[model samples]
Target: MYENSTELAENKLLLLHIIKSVTIPISNTQLTDIVLENSFVNYFTLQQYITELINTDFLKYVEVNKKKSLQLTQKGENVLMLFKDRISPSKLNQIDEYIHTKIESLKKEFSITADYLPANKDSFIVNLKAIENDTLLLDLKVNVVSKKQAVDLCTKWKHNSADIYNKILNALINE
Candidate 1:
C-alpha cells in the first residue's frame, strides 16, 4: 500500500515535470496523449491527478490563441523543484528521450492548421494558417460556394501550406 501511494505521488510529479518541460501551454488532450503515450499512467488516474492539481492551484486553465490550454502554476513549479528528486535519474532521462521524439511532431501539428466555418446559406469560409512560434506566416480566408469545396481547400491547405505559400509569394514578387 505504501508502494502504491509512492507510485501515485511519482506519477503526479511526473505530470508536473512534463508540463514544465514542455515550455509552452498545452491542451488537456495533448497532455493526456503525452502521458498515455509514454505509459506513465492510466487515463482515469491521470484525470484524477489533474483535478487535484487544479484544485490545489498547481495547475490552471488558460486561453492561448483563443483555445484552452493547461499551464503549471507558480506553486506547482516550487513543488516540483522541491520534490523532483523523488523521480529517478534514469526515469528522468527516459522522459527527456520520449519528449524529444514527440516534440517535433507536436510542434508541426500546431504550426500548420486549417479549418472551415459557415459563412452563408450556401457558402463556407476556409480559414488556413501557417504559424510558427506565434507568428503568422500565412493567414488566408477563402469563400467557397459549397461545404465540400471548403473542406477540400482546408485539407489541401493543411497538407500543402508551405508549397502554396511559396508559389503565391513567387507569383506576386515575380509578376
Candidate 2:
C-alpha cells in the first residue's frame, strides 16, 4: 500500500514537471493528452488530479483568445523544482520527445484563422488565412449577402485550406 501511494505521488510530481516545462500555457486537452499518451494516468484519474491541483492552488486556469488553458502557479513551480527528482531521467526524456514532436503541429493548427465582418447591413465579408512559421501563405476575403454564408465559408476554409490552396496554385500556374 505504501508503494502504491509512493507511485501516485511520483506521478503527480511528474505531471507538475510536465506542466512547468512548457514555455506557453497549454490547453487542458493538450495536457491531458500528453499524460494519456505516455500512459502515466487514466483519463478519469487525470481529471481528478487536475481538480485536485486547482483546488490546492498549484495550477490556475486562464483563457487565451477565448480558449481555456492551464498555467502553472508559482507554488506549482516551486513544488516541482523541489520534487523533480521524484521523476526518472528516462521518463523526463520521454515527455520531452513527445512535446517536441507535437508542438509544431499544434502551432500550425492554430495558425489557420477565420473571421467575418459586417460589410453592410445586408452583406458580410469572410476573411480566412493560413500562416506557416509566422508567414502568411494565404489570405482570402469574400463578400456574401448573408451572415450564414459568411460563417459557412469561414468554416469551410479552415477545414479545406490545403486542398483549396493547392487548387488555386495549380489553376494559376496552368493559366
Candidate 3:
C-alpha cells in the first residue's frame, strides 16, 4: 500500500480521468507521454500510481491489436465520477487540450505494428501492418527461414512502413 497523500490521490485520479476521457484503451507509453509532457508527475511516480490503480481494480490492462494497453475499469469510471473534482481545473483542462491535440497521431503511431512468430522448426512468420482509424491500410505476412531475417523485416517495416506502403501501392497501381 502507498501513502494516501493528497498529491498522490489527485495524480491517480487525473490518470483515471484521462483514460476515461479517451474512451478507448491506450498504450502505457502514450499515457506516460501525455502525463509527463504536461509535468503532471514524474515517471517513477506515474508508474507507481498506475500500479496502484491496477492493484485496486481502478484500471486494468487489455490487449488491443496484440499490444498491451491500459484501460479504465467500471470501478475506475465510478471513482472518477465521484471524486474527479480533486483534480485542479487547470490541470484537467491541460490534459484535455493535450489529448485532443495528439490523440489522432498517437493512434496512428500505434496502429503501425510488426511482430514475428515461429512457424515451425526452421521458419518464422512476420506480420506487418499499417492501420488508420481502425482501417487496415496494409497487412503483410512474410515467411522467412531464419529468425534474424524475420526480425530484420519487422524492424525495417516499423522504421519505414510508410515508405514501404507507398512503394507497394505504386508498384501495384503503375504499369
Best by lDDT: 3
Between prediction 1 and prediction 2, the one with superior lDDT is 1
What is candidate 3's lDDT per residue for 34-86, written digit by digit as tens? 88899988899889889999999999999988889999989999999999999
For candidate 3, report its TM-score: 0.80
**Best first by TM-score, ranked:** 1, 3, 2
Give the winner by TM-score: 1
Residue 58 in model 2: lDDT: 89
What order do you get sorting by lDDT, best first?
3, 1, 2
- How much does each candidate deviate from the true structure in C-alpha RMSD? 2.0, 4.8, 2.8
Give the alpha-carbon lDDT of every model: 0.85, 0.81, 0.88
> Which one wins by TM-score: 1 or 2?
1
TM-score of 1: 0.89
Global CA lDDT of candidate 1, please?
Answer: 0.85
